[model samples]
Target: MQRLAGNLRTIDPEASESLRIVSYFDVLISRGASVDALLRGAAVMASAVVGATVRGRTIRRDADGRTPREETPTTSSRIDGGEWTAWIERPGVPAPLDDVILERLALGIALIESRRRLPGGVEVIIDAGMGEAERVAVLARMRIDPGALVRVIASPAGALSGADDAVILPTRRALVRVRLDRELVPPQKPGPWGLGTVVRADRAPESLETALIALRLTDERDRVVDASELGSFLLLARAFDPDHPPADVVALSALDERSRHVLRALAEAESMRSASAALGMHHSSVQARHEALTQTLGYDPRTPLGRARYVAAALLMRLAES
Candidate 1:
């Protein structure tokens, strides 16, 4: 068995490379090698390759039947450490692991995280702005719903809001944001999920506050699991920004004397249209402003925190002199 395994390792035939990697592992397991060790080795190699490729390292080939590694200028200089080369040199490489194929795996993880963090009406913000082809590629890599990514953009106020609120464009540079309902539904426990919250520093002026103070929520997902927990996870994630205070804390700070008045009018609004009329704008304009308020206030019906924003904005506006 040892001799056979040895022979398998020496053979470099393309047809046998995959078979060798698989059979090698089987033999190692039968010989009492730890399976976790094998897996860790594979993961280490995979991470290295991805880190290197993302940094632009390429394998150089010459007529000597040996391929040396070289890096291209086009490769971003941000590649991680040298551990990846160590993986290739390890006793046996795993089947799914490739010396040069790191992007696929890293992208898979990123895409998975993107889905895990899905926000209502949220989409993945690619490192480079995404296009149809890019979106298709991302979905394929992540194995997610095709419609998962939709176009979004920042508002004139520099808040990361959806473009559908104001102007229309075929392609635009934007950050991803998700919106939730105005009430909180109890979320199921023990689910595949995560939550995050963002808050802005209060001392800064309005323009800076708008730029920095945006709230986002997402569910850190693993395969299909409980719907309720997933929803709750997203709720918490949006509300769990480490840098800023809780959504409620920052939101209160966001509404100064005048903005508080506007929010009050908004909360009292029967519908977005009614809110518009009360704010003294066209219904269409009010809807845009309302949408902006919703983004600013981080109101989602699925969670208690969101409800507070919904209520506070309205109650505050009513106190203002008409």
Candidate 2:
């Protein structure tokens, strides 16, 4: 089809380009591509940024197929597709094919969103932004008891396998699997997973929020973090401001990787000797590194207060990077 389109373009560029746009979206719809994928396709095809607003959430992708670091003024080529609206960001003047791309993009988005509203559409069930009445209706449609408990498991996109009973929805940060708590099984693969606390089906958005936070706290030492076990740590993660992180978080970010690894070991290990063993270094060497770390960080990571500070800084550092 692409070869034909390329050949046809040499004869009639306008008609060939229109055929190309239709073909691009038809293939995406056939494969059930995610909204992110659809927006990225439009962005690339139009050589500009594209965005969609669904359920009060706005997602955008740049022409390079990455989320734009900042927002810029956009062209007025927005198209409404029932449950969602799609737009192109071409600034001064729109490209010739921008209209067709935006039209097909909106059609693709509508098809995906409509399918997600059907029975067993776990996307609607776990969406925090959906109305209570709508959620209850969806639960009834899917034959899910509103009072029954469920958990939202969040992992990197395409990370989970054999999720036959769960609806895997792609969010900006992760792929969330919403399934009944009773049916939840340990993931088959190693994970940097965030397991949300079990909650009533209607309160899934709350679960998803904490699950994503727990995911952010995961590191090499602790690959899986359960939100139910977080306690006060959950509060700290919520209260942290990524845009203006605390001084300790900033300091931790400035250190080299080796220094950060040593600090992580010091924070987790019960003693200097244990820390050295974990790092495969001599105890005396670890002791000297600890002294240097104290001077560099302006705090003793081994002390009770300093340990708490280090833990917060390290976790917040992850949040900032994410």
Candidate 3:
């Protein structure tokens, strides 16, 4: 169809004769040539290129190109008896060829691989410089659970502890004191990193501590911050069961080091997703294990009260074990 200069793979001299004539006419017009004179010259050129017998008529431009009028034979013309018409259209507007093609290629790749990956199971975190609203929009597009995703600093305090009371400020500045554990972070390729999901407080125990410390530091620095810091701290402590351990409440005959290790991982992780990823297991598996542990340890891991008891038991057991 449509005639585009970029799409011109081959040029036909005979077919393009009209185009050349039009270009010449345009140049003449730009140099202060009369419109009527240019039109007459174009007509003469068209006639000579094909034949004098062929009547040169200009039709309005169509969606494809300039459509020519049907020719009528003139009596005193030195031309072959055949219908020949000239078509011309504008020549310089360029389309977005590369962008369209690249987008199509990306869509094709995504379609092919979409079926192979797990169903919305992958976690991705983008670091600072990503504004909150923009980050939310991106995560929403990726189908990631916002509650499960962690956004923090590159330092130790940026990570989350099990404390739900730890606060996150609204400022756009980067943090310096906290760092998330690298183990729970997604792999990043070396490049100009604008954004991606990396380490968070949910990554490890040390990571969680970093988050808490960061919050504490921020709190000590200023008092005008929102409830984010305090809420984070409280939630984190409940999640980690800092004051309760399984050993403190559960009899020594009931649990082992492996079970405690799993519990500690849960307590340390900021979210269940992080905990599951850390353990290299499905979330369901972790939940099932916690359920069984709860039955044996006489407490539920999902409940805040149960977590508190578990922490106490754990601390007491650690003392006894030592």
Number of colliding residue pairs in each model = 28, 0, 56
lDDT of 2: 0.76
Per-residue lDDT of candidate 1, residues 108-143 (tens digit):
323333443343121222221123444445455544
Model 3 stretches with alpha carbons more than 4 Å out:
1-248
By TM-score, rank the candidates, best first. 2, 3, 1
Query: Cα deviation in Å at residue 137, candidate 3?
Result: 70
Candidate No. with top lDDT: 2
TM-score of 3: 0.23
RMSD of 2: 6.6
How far residue 317's Cα lies from its native spot in candidate 2, in Å, is 2.2
lDDT of each: 0.33, 0.76, 0.37
Per-residue lDDT value at 30 in model 1: 31
Models 1 onward score TM values of 0.20, 0.68, 0.23
TM-score of 1: 0.20
**Residue-level error in angstroms, candidate 1, position 258:** 3.9
Q: How far in Å is the alpha carbon of 121 misplaced in model 1? A: 62
Q: Which pairs clash inside model 2?
A: none
